[model samples]
Target: MTPYDAAHSQGSNVLTDGFGRTVTYLRVSVTDRCDLRCVYCMSEHMTFLPKAEVLTLEELDRIASAFVGLGVKKLRITGGEPLVRKNVMGFIEGLSRHLRSGALQELTLTTNGTQLEQFARPLAEAGVRRINVSLDTLKPELFRRLTRGGEIARVLAGIDAAQAAGLKVKINAVALKDDNAAELPELIRWAHGRGLAVTLIETMPMGEIDADRTDQYLSLSALRAELESFWTLRELPLTTGGPARYVEVAETGGQLGFITPLSHNFCEACNRVRLTCTGTLHTCLGREDAADLRAVLRGGGSASDLVDAIRMAVDTKPKGHDFHIERTLPPAVARHMSTTGG
Candidate 1:
């Protein structure tokens, strides 16, 4: 048995936060560099971290294995665009052993879909069953304006490639008042027609961008009320181990999800934590509390030490986040979502 398996054999290592919530999901950011600079996610001229500051691929594997051994059932690889990271596929393949051994129940990712065409087949072969692609708008010009030169055609092509590779594709659209509000219904229809699950997310208060986030914030509750005019949405009792709340649209016979971080607080059952590429562990997305695991890794800390650090971080997990958007105030968290892992 592997060292990870041996760690899992001890029942005392399971991670349970102070609120009695079990942490079974972990989002690991491989890199804070992306090919496209979405207005909300990052500044057009982003200053990325140095290569030495980020953990090595081997270190990433070691940290993630420690989490799996501590009872993390689902692992989602995220990034400023994870596909842009060199040798990321090899890292993902390395993690697939946990899935094969039943130590991890699910392994997946969230991407901008720009590189899906090149990596889709390899991802499926690496044991990824589903992936969430961030596509804000379908209009070519609007898409370019939103992403600062991202090609919608390329993203669409990548989506097609992912579906062809037998990976279940889900579209994640960050609902913006001025950007894609009108086009969302059409986007939903198109996605549902293609048998893809679409999730509408309220624009979050994260990072300092060129655009005013207060102006960009579109409440999912308001958007849902607007959709009710043309379509009947019935709330479904489904939890994907994420913050999204699902609903079934009667007209399209498709599933739609809403992630309302501002309009609604979906934090009572928070079971996930984010690990940045730099090895910072964020117990809550909207809060600033974090634990650095890179220090332990580089300081020659043992695997048991890594596990103890993770448990201590989980012990300090907050009940919820404090995310609010106002023109008068700064972002809830000073760090960018890219730095925090999507």
Candidate 2:
């Protein structure tokens, strides 16, 4: 039976298909407009996607519903900053109702954390309980300098508001060598006190920062050794077959995660697929291949048909990302994290 036809019974839920692979998670980018001009993501003079081409709420709702119907249990709404989009909470409310029907189990959102304060309470009420906030530094001057126009205080305040609103908050810190690697110890301590999880990710080799082999660009393997002094970190378990190598701070109630895409590719365990803000289905984040979902949607295909297409795309997911950065390997189509869904 086709992956779609097998969806009715959990006993028959298959990760593998005709292509022999399983599918599960989906990441949706809500918008391409970001408040912070993070040096890595863009230039001070970067131009964003035209508002006309961006997907409307109705379009997003339709595509998201189709994914859930295909047995996608986890959904993460990403963006230039998902909250910057108009009526985003309404979209979340609509998604929550879908989850209530068993097509979904978790609905999460990722943001830069600058606009969280005003949004936290209302967003929590709208049924968003999990939040991943990107925070590169704790130092004001450095934070502003790195994030360009971001206010560290505002981001921190947003974190507080979200925590107060009872959202499960996690801070994402993308580190480079001389930049904020030194602040990892302090950041981890702060997160533990507030019961928040912290994930330190390596900067993908792209954008202006891609060049300049400065001391700022450190690897994930190195981050572990750097933190050994402060806390006795022990490996924890995964959630829903997650691929991150997690470690808990034994003394504190906090945890740390490492997404070492470059050093250690998790291609074998990659069950996720990406959809750009415009509606292209990306089978691999580091692969040039993508199936055009917009064409199918605009062609007046039914939602069930869309789900079947997703299953086919998922089954054919590449064995692993090419780390296509090295000159020896062919490059994936040049869509960076900022342009694609972060």
Candidate 3:
């Protein structure tokens, strides 16, 4: 039997998927355009969506308000790089108003750390409580190779600014075999020194970029084994709303997290859906099951109509997804990680 609850229909605005997962977290991609050309995300000289096709801040505010009304407690602003979008601070401040009004419980952001130094204080003032920055390699030369001209110093400066601004910061590292795999211990130590947690994620096969993904498929098991060889890991209580498995590093008295989307499946506990900048509701990351929320928004739909559309999208959520590297590419694998708000 599928793990669906048919009794709760579209009439009510509760966002529960087929697997009995109560969806409360909404990741909103503000823009698909990014400044950096990471090896695993997109190719150099990429084409971005036209400005007219992107949703205005007002439209995003309305859509976000509707989701909050349906019991969404948390909202994460994501992007190719959220800071790269124009007037992003204003957008964040608007979301902050929702938090202030008690309509939202948490407002956070996931950024590439390229532009955090300039926006950290303003962002925190805007009521963003937590921030997640993507940092794969600590070494400058390696960072340049991976991100294609990204400066390590700038990211480090951004992290410093985030910390100084009194915002809770975390580092997200994508584990790549024979690439940054060996640097895990050092990376952990560096992040721990700054009182920040590090979440090492096994790279998922999102899009076909200019990289040998087959060689880059490093398992979380390998990463954990490498860490265990030096430091002791103690299982910690799960408090974060995301899928990462947390462990306390006994050596540094710091926290370490593993998001093993590829090796270990966490779909059974999935409780989130993605809203692209184009206003499409993607029920699953590894599946192409999407509903055009933009169409509903632009078709003279009422607030109730928008809620009904979201309900219908949640109803079509898959029980689980089959995301693994295949000799032949999977249809869903065509999704660019950048565009998907990964």
lDDT of 2 by residue, 27-78 (tens): 8888878888887666677678887667777777777766665667788898
- Candidates 1 and 2 compared by lDDT, better number: 1
lDDT (Cα, tens digit) per residue for candidate 3, span 1-342: 111122222355467877688999999999998878888788776778888888887777777777887878899999999899888887788777668778678999999998999999998899887899999989999999888899989889999999999999999999888888889888999899889999998878787677657778888987798788888999999767888999999999899999987788888888888998989888888887789888987898877788888888987898777688755664346778788886
lDDT of 3 at 136: 94
Question: What pairs collide in candidate 1?
Answer: none
Better of 1 and 3 by TM-score: 1
| lDDT scores in order | 0.92, 0.75, 0.84
* Model 3 stretches with alpha carbons more than 4 Å out: 1-13
Candidate 3 C-alpha error for residue 57, in Å = 1.5
Worst 10 residues of 1 by lDDT: 1-10
For candidate 3, give the lDDT of residue 102.
82
Q: TM-scores of the models, in the given order? A: 0.97, 0.89, 0.94
Count clashing residue pairs per candidate: 0, 6, 1
Question: CA shift at 90, candidate 3, in angstroms?
Answer: 1.1
User: After TM-score superposition, what is the CA distance of residue 100 in candidate 3 from its true location, in Å?
Assistant: 1.2
As a whole number from 0 to 100, the lDDT of residue 305 in candidate 2 is 65
